[model samples]
Target: MTDQALPRVVDQATWQHELDALRVREKAATRELDAIAAQRRRLPMVALPDYTLTGADGPVRLVDLFDDRQQLITYHHMWFPDAEWQCGGCTSFTAQFTRLEFLAPYDARFVVVTQGPIGEALAYKEKVGNKMDWYSTADSPFGADMGAGPGEGFAVNVFLRDGDTVHRTWHTDGRGTEQLTHTFALVDLLPYGRQEEWQDSPPGWPKTSTYSKWPGSEDVAAAYGPQGVSA
Candidate 1:
């Protein structure tokens, strides 16, 4: 079925009636999301050793990523030196973090960790117009310990700091990565949905396997037009 076949046009009263019914389900879903977060907060954490990573300024330890904050949020952006292209999926996820100030009130430091030189990581960051801290774990065991096992995993690992010790409280990859990208969440609400082949979209809806196709830095600078990306 196509979009025209679904969600038939309705009068004001009928629309309101259907919306009111869906509101009940929406509220229940919100509560369930809250409960899941509560359960996540209660999960056991693992102590992590201090690992070295390269930043624009220079080398820094893992604890340094906390930036004096109690919590550290890291995105495991998949990038290997041998590959010519950055992972488009990672770029799509990293693109949403351009607004670095939004997380300030939460009292946590956010960063992206990758497996390349600082310059290479910076190139990818430049392409995405990223503002959050970007780090390179080329010579570190960080990825081996916390990252996705093969094919350059896109993952997020949350750490909590207590004095001199840091513990990994949560780590997730694959579909769990959806929790970050607003694009994914917003697209899910649209009539055509994500418009990706894997999604359960309507029969005639657009579908592509290249959902993560990333553009080059110059392309982003041209497309962004201002604010974040600059030539």
Candidate 2:
């Protein structure tokens, strides 16, 4: 285990060959994922249930939020009223929000649903400078019906609606999994990088840090309101 006796990984020719093989595998994986995505898109539509939810503009119909867009992506942000603050992971992930604007040409709309009041939702959006559309379920039952209320967990669910019919195309509620897809996925394909310094990063790549709760962190409340922040 001494330094001199350790294997030399930095100067190995085999390493390059292994990297090449990995590149091929990555390409194949990408192709397979694209095919599966196509299948999801082709799935048949279902009737969109009647639902009303709070919006920055006021109480609004679920279908109306579609804004005539054929595809809608909703992020069920953990924005409960009594909750202290928004999820930090969500805050970080939201750095990718502006990218959603580009999807407009494809007839896709992205929105975030919060359990907080519309004013609260708006405040958070302003504080974070998020350009994506945001709505609240504070005065309505939409979040509960969508399984996005308190205790419901964090998720991003995509729905496809054709006229009055709606179909849930996909749902992802897992941690950090959102980075795997979206226009961001396309960006990650570029040579410069995805910028996420996860464990799978190649050698010498910088790793990123996850936020840690420190002493008195609970005292810091969300500026949205007295109860809007998290511990």
Candidate 3:
């Protein structure tokens, strides 16, 4: 970290008093989020028609992604046509899907779906975490219909499967998936926010464009951290 302008140093009592005020607002915001979630759960669901999606295991039905589970949460991963790489923002977001075994006990399945070829999707996992479950939507409109072709960006689709019926419960776009990154939340808590140009950092604080510092080569990972979680 470099020397930069910092929030004014304060006395212990003054710090506590300031923290107390923020805590009240934080509590209220948290409750509001909880209420929002309840409403999200109650939102109407849209049925998905039978469609094909390719995985490392070859062509498979969309329902197969559910893995005999009643619920499936898929990250609508973005891919480039060049077949050499993936979107950095998508990489940063999908990295959190690792170690999500906790979803299994609850009968939920998580997957990353891409419109690129299966080979590219598979190569993505190899460059990143080989353990990640990545799929290719191929020529199928399954991804576009479910909200992938819109902005050439990404989304998170929540689904509920009952017998042969597949229902889309909730879906969130790129910005909506921001909460998946615990690291970003941690960064927000710091005096300097993300140190990225897109963020409104104070003068003298480090800043870079959100898309800057991307890995120059497809094989190399971006500098999200030493652990390979690309920002």
Q: Local error of candidate 1 at 49, Å?
A: 1.3
| Candidate order, TM-score descending | 3, 1, 2
| Candidate number achieving the greatest lDDT relative to the actual structure | 3
Q: What is the lDDT of residue 103 in candidate 2?
A: 78
Decreasing lDDT order of the candidates: 3, 1, 2
TM-score of every model?
0.85, 0.71, 0.87
Q: What does candidate 2's lDDT look like per residue over 1-231, in tens digits?
A: 543223246656788988799999999999998998899768765555767887877878877778989888888877646554566556545534556667789998888887878887787666655666888877777677666776567787778887776777776677545553464566556543454545355565544443332212122224222454421
Off by over 4 Å in 3: 1-3, 198-204, 213-231
Q: Listing every candidate in turn, what is its Cα RMSD in Å to the true structure after a full C-alpha superposition?
A: 3.3, 6.8, 3.5
Candidate 3's residue-wise lDDT over 44-74, tens digit each?
Answer: 9988799888888888998888889999998
Instruction: State in Å the error of residue 130, model 1.
Output: 2.3
- Tell me the number of clashing residue pairs for each predicted model: 0, 6, 1
Residue pairs clashing in model 3 are 197-208
What would the per-residue lDDT of candidate 1 be over residues 95-207, giving only the tens digit for each residue? 65667776667878889888777888787676556666788887787876887433467789999999878999998888887877787677678876765677776666667
Pairs clashing within candidate 2: 84-228, 84-229, 84-230, 85-229, 85-230, 222-229
Best by TM-score: 3
